[model samples]
Target chain A: MKDHEAVIVGVADAPLINGKVAQPGSALQIVARCAKAALDEAGLTLGDVDGLFTAGMWGIPGVGQLPTVTLSEFLGIRPVVHDGTNIGGSAFEAHLGHAALAIEQGLCDVALIVYGSAQRSEMSRNLAGRPATLTMQFETPWGLPTPVGGYALAAMRHMHEYGTTREHLAEIAVAARAWAGLNPAATKRDPITVDDVLAAPTISKPLGLLDCCLVTDGGGAIVVTRASHAKAQGLKPIHVRGHGQAATHWTIAAMPDLARLTAAEMASERAFAMAGVTHDAIDLVEVYDSFTITTLLTLEALGFAERGGGGEFVSNGRIAPGGAFPLNTNGGGLSYAHPGMYGIFLLIEAVRQMRGEVEPERQIANVRTALVHGTGGTLSSGATCILSLD
Target chain B: MTKPHPVVDPGTAPYWAALKEKRLILKSCRACGQAHFYPREICPHCYSDDLDWIEAKGTGEIYSYTVAVRPAGQAFEADAPYTIAIVTLDEGPRMMTRIVAADADAVEIGKKVTVRFVEEDDLVLPFFALGGA
Candidate 1:
C-alpha cells in the first residue's frame, strides 16, 4: 500500500443493553462514548484526532444546522478538518470517503467518523414528528406514511412490472433473522419463516411489519489513518479501497424510476471501478435494509443480480447463513438494531468481518474483500464502499 | 386529531388556489414542452424559467399505491387503512395523493383514476378515486 493510503484502524459501537441504549442515553452521550472507544482501540487519544466527521438526525433544528460544531463542542476536540454531510442515513458512508480523501491529501492524518441515535428512547422513530413543509407538504397532507409508504409504493411498482411477490420479499427478512440468530448483539434472534413474515400485521399494503427494520438506540464510530501509520503502530489495517455516493431525488414521487434504484447503480459502478474488483471477488456483502424492498432493489442495482431479478437472486435461503451468499451478516437493520439511521452499522459490520472479529459461527471463512452500501431517505441516496484485508 | 395541512408558499400558491376552485393545474415548460408537479418556477426538465400553468384533465392511472394499515399518526387514525398512491396524471407528471375507494381491492396498479376535491377547514385537497368508483 502507498504510504499515505487510507486504512481503518479502529471501529466500535456504543454500549447497548439488550439492543437498547441503557438509560441516560442521549445522542451526544452515545456518540461521544463511541468516539472515545474507537479512538482508544486505535491506541490514540482525542488529541490525536485532526479530522472529525459526523452526520445524524439529532438535536433537531440545532444539530440539523451545525452538527459538526455541536459534536466538536460536546466531544471537546476542535479539529482543523471536519465535515457534516447529512444526506440522510448514508451520510457516514459519504463521510468515510471524505475522510480518506483528506488523509491522502495530507489535509489531516487521523480521521474519526462517528454517528449516534436515540430514536427509540426518545420515541421519535415514527412519522409523527414530521411537519408538512416544502416537498413533504405534498406527501404528509395525504396521510402517506413517510419512508415506509414510499418504499411500499416502489414495491408495488416492482411487483407490477416484474411479478415480484410478498414471498420473495419475505425471504429477505428470513435471511436477516437467520443471521441474527447467530449474533448476540442482534435485537431479534427468533427464527422466522417466510410464512411468518407474510402473516405479520401489515404496516402498509405490500409491506408487513417483518418487512421493516427494527427500531432501537445505538451509536458507532470508525478511526482512519494512513497505512504507514497503522504499520508503524503494529495494527492490522482494513484498506479503504474505494467509495462512491450519489442521490437522485429526496421525494419518492420525484424518483426517476420507481422500479429501479438509479443512485445505487451510479454509486456501486464507481466503487467497483475504483477498487478494480468484480462482483464475484467480494467475499461478503452488507447493504442498508431499512425495508425488504430496499434490499431487493439494492441487490439488483449493485449488479449482483440483473434488474428485476432480485426476487430470484435472494430466493430459497440464498442469502441466509451457510447459504451461497453472505449478506447483512450482522442480521442487518431488519433484525439488528436500526436506531433510526442505519448506515453507520453497515460499516461497523463490514470492518468486523474483514478483521475476523465476529463470533466464530457468524464469521465468514477466508473473507478477504467486502462491500458495504448504504441507502438513505425514501430510496433517495446511495453510498457504497469497497474494503479489503489485502 | 387533524391531519396536516399543506404549508403554501408563493411558488405553490397558484396550484393550491386552483384546487380550491376544484380544478387541477400543472406547470408546463414552454421550452421543453414537458409538464412538472409541485409547481416550480424553473422547469426541472430543461432549466427554463419560461413556464405556463395549464388545466390538467384530472384523469390518470394508478402508477403505484399503498394502504396505510397503520396510519402515519393520531391525525390519521380515523383513516387507518387509507390508500396512498402515486398517480401518473394525463399531463405526464406523477403526483403523491390519496386513492379514495370503498374497497381496498379497487386500488391497483394501472387502474384508471380521476381526481376529486375534498375541503378541510380553509384548505381544499385533491384526492383520486378509481374511474369505476
Candidate 2:
C-alpha cells in the first residue's frame, strides 16, 4: 500500500435506539454527535479534521450551506473539501471512494463522512397527505410504490422462474434478526425465526412486515486519513483496497431485468477484483437490508450464494453468529435504525467489526477483511467497498 | 398535435405524442439509422442530434418481466398481482408497461405483444397485451 491509501483507522457509531444517550435529538444533532465520536475515537479533536464529506444531495442543495455547515460552525473550523452526493443512499460509499482519491492527492488528513435523516416521519407525513410516497411519487402513478413493492415485484419474477419463495426471503430477515440479537444497540434485538417472519404482518404480498427494514431517525460516521498519517498518529488503519460503483438505468421502469440486481452484481465484481478477494475469502459481509428480499437477492448477486439458492444458503442458522458467514452484525437496516442513510451504517459496522470493539458475541471471529455494499433508489444505483486489515 | 399525458419534456414531447393515437414511436437518426425508445434527444448508440419520430407497427416481444405480487406505496395497493414487463419493441427499444391477456402464470420471455393504448387523465398511455390474445 502507498503511504497515503485512504484508510479508515477509527470509527464511532451513535447508539441507534434511545437509551443512555441524551433523549430526543434531531437528525442534525445525531450527525454532530457521531462525527464528534468518530474523531474522538481516532484520538483526534475536531480541529484535526481538515476535510468533511457529506452524503445525499438533500437536507441542503446550495453550496457553503449544509446541515454540516452548522456542525462545522460549532467546531469553528471551515472544511477544505465539502463533498455532497445525491445518489440516494449510495452517496456515502461514493463519498468514501472520492475521499480516498482526494486523500491520495494531499487534499486532507482526516475526512469525516456523516449522514442522518427522519425518513420515518418524512415518509409518514408524505403518505398521509401526498397521493404517493416521495420515493414512489413518480412511478407509483404507474403502480410502482414503496421499495418493498418494487422489489417484491422483482422477487415475484424470480419466484416465477427460479422458484424463490417467501420462506427464502424470510430467511434473510431471520438471519439478520439473529445477528441483531447479539447487538447491544439494535432496535429489534429479539431473535426471529423464518416462520415468525412469514407470519408477520403483510406490508406487501410475499413481502410481510419482517421482510422490510426499520425506519428511524439516526446517524453514523467513519473517519478516513492517509494510512501513514493514521499510523503516525498511533491508530490502526483499515486499507481501502477495493471500491467500485455501477448503475444500470436511472429508472426501474426502463431496466432490462428485474429478477437480479445487475448493477450490484457488477459493482461487487469490480470491488472484489479490486480487493483481490473471493466470496469465500471475505470474513464479514454487510449487505444493505432496505428490504429482506434485497439481502437475499444481493447475496446471490454478490456471488455469496448461487442464483435462487440464497434461501437454501441462508436457511438453518447459517448466517448468524458461529454460522458459516457473519452478515450485518450491526443489525443492518432491518433491525438497526435505518435513518434514511444505510450506506453510512454499513461502513460504520464494518469499521467497528474490523476494529474489534464490537460486543464480543456479535463479533465475527478472524475477520481480517469485510465487504460492505450499498443500494440507492429502487436499486437504481449501487456501490461496494471492501475494507481490509493487513 | 402537442404531446399529452406528461411525456411533454423538451427532449421527449414528440415521442409521447407519437405513442398516443396508436403510433409506436422511436427516434430514428437520419444520419445513423438507429431506433430507440423512452426517447432521448441524443442517440445512445451514435450520439447524434439528427433524429426524427417514426411510427412503429406496435409489435414486440417480452425481454423480461416481473409480477407485482405485493402492492406497495399508496397508489398501487389495489393493483396487486399485476404483470409488468419490459417489452422489446419491434423498433428495438424496450419499455415498461403492464401486459394484459397474460396472468402472472402465463407471462414468459420472448412472448409476442402488441402496443395498446390505455387512457388516464385524458392521456393515452401505450400499454401491451398478448399478441394473439
Candidate 3:
C-alpha cells in the first residue's frame, strides 16, 4: 500500500467529563487501560501493535517515555513511531496523520493513538499550580487561570460582534442534553431543557453552567489500520477519505479572527477534498464540543449552517437524532464525556456510526460519510478527518 | 507563604510588575508585525528571538465578553458575577481581562472599553470598564 492510504479498522474510548478525564494527570494508569481496551476492540493484542501516540496531560512533570517505549515496557509492545504530544485534544488526530505517514513510509503497521487524563481526580498537581508550559504565563499574570476564561473571552466577543445571545448558546447545551438523554454513558443524562440550561449556574459570564463541560476522570483510544491489511484480515475498514489540520495561531490574541476559528475551516476544506465528498454528503458530524460555542463555530465553519446561524440551527433540532446532521451521538462532551482529547471520542463515535453498531434510538440513519473534528488548547489547535464506509 | 503563590517566572515578571503599577503592556514581535499578549520569550507566530514589551494605550474595544455567575478555582471566589472579557486592543491584538462598571445587559460587542487594574491574589489584574466612563 502507498502512503496516505491507511484506514481506521478499530476504535474505543474510556470516557469523558466536561471535556476532561478523571485520571490524576499523567497517571500512566489511565493510558494503559484505554490502550488495552482499544487493542482488544481491534482484536489485536499488545504484541500485534508496533506504534503508539499519546497526548493531553499536564500530569507527568517531566517524563520522557513515549507510549511505544513505556507501554512496550508496561504492556510489552514495541514499535518505531512513539509520539507523545500535548496540543490539547487535537493531538490525537495529528498522531493519526503521523501514524498514517509512518505506515505509508513502511515504518510501522499498527499505530495506536491514545489519550487519558484524570483531570477531575484528586491529587491532581497542575490545575492549582501552573504546569512547566502554559500558553497563559504572560497573559494569565493579568490573571487568566484556566482555559475556560480564555474561551469565555471569545464567547463574549462572538456575542458583541454578532447578535449571538446567551439564549443562543443555551441552545447548544440543551440540544446536547437532549441527545444525551438516550445515551446512558453521558455524565449529565437527566434530560435538561433549554429553560433548565438557561437557569443553570454560570461558570464564566456569557457562558453559563451548561455552556461549560464536565471535567471527569477518563481515557479514550483509536487504532489506525493499513487498508490493505484490514481487507485481507477481514477487519471492518473505515476509509479515511481526507484529513486536514492547521495550527497557525500561537495564542488566542494572535488569531486573525477570534470570533471564528479559521483553522476549523481550513481543516474541513482539506478533509472534504480528500474524502471526495461535499458537506452535503456527510450524514453525521462528531465535532468537539469543549464548549457550546465550539460546536456553533465549527458548525458554521464546516458549512453545516451559516455563521451566527448555528444557534438557530441547533435550536431548531437539526443536529438532534432524526435531524439532518446528528452530532456527538455518545452525548458529546456535555452529556457523554469529554476526557480531554475529545477528538478521540469523536472518532470512536463516528466509527460506531459507520459500522451500524450505534444503539438504535441514538443512531443517525444512513451514516455513509461522517465528519469528525477535534480541538486542542482552547481552540488554539484544530484537526478535521472525513471517514466513510464502502 | 499564603495560598496562590503565583511564582513569577523570568519571562513574565515584567508584565506582572507593570500590571501592579496599573499599567498594561504587550509584547510586539519585530520579526512579524503582530502584537501578542501573554508575552512569551519568542514570537507565537515567527518564533523569532526578536521580541520586546511595550505599554498598551489602555483603550480597546470589548471584542467579546461575559460575566461569571459561578466562582472558578480559589482565586475568584469573591469575584463571582464579575465580568470577564476579551478586549481587542487598539494595537490589533486581543487581551483577556475582567469587566467592571457595566452590568451584563449594558455590555455590548464593539462597545468601547478602557483598562483598569483589580488587585487580587497578590496580582494586579487588568480589567476593562465601559470606555466612555
- Highest TM-score model number: 1
Across A1-390, the per-residue lDDT of candidate 2 in tens digits comes to 577688886676666443222344655666678878888888777788888877633344343256456657756768888786656677788888878878888888788888756555445323111232332222444554455556665666677678788887887787788777888788888888888988887654567778878867666778888877777888878888788888876556555577788878888888889889887778888978898878877888898889878778887777767777778887788887677668888988888788787899887777788888898877777889998987
Evaluated on chain B only, what is the TM-score of candidate 3? 0.83
lDDT of each: 0.90, 0.72, 0.72
Once fitted onto the true fold, the runs of candidate 1 whose alpha carbons sit more than 4 angstroms away are: none
iRMS per model, in Å, is 1.2, 6.3, 3.8
Indicate the docking level reached by candidate 3.
Answer: acceptable
- For every candidate in turn, the CA RMSD to the true structure comes to 1.3, 4.2, 3.8
What lDDT tens digits, residue by residue, belong to model 3 across residues A147-226? Answer: 66667777776776677887788777877887888876678777776788778776666667688776666677788867
Candidate 2 backbone collisions, by pair:
A57-A86
Error of 1 at A390 (Å): 2.7
Interface RMSD of 1: 1.2
RMSD of model 3 against the true structure: 3.8
Residue A186 of model 2: what lDDT? 80
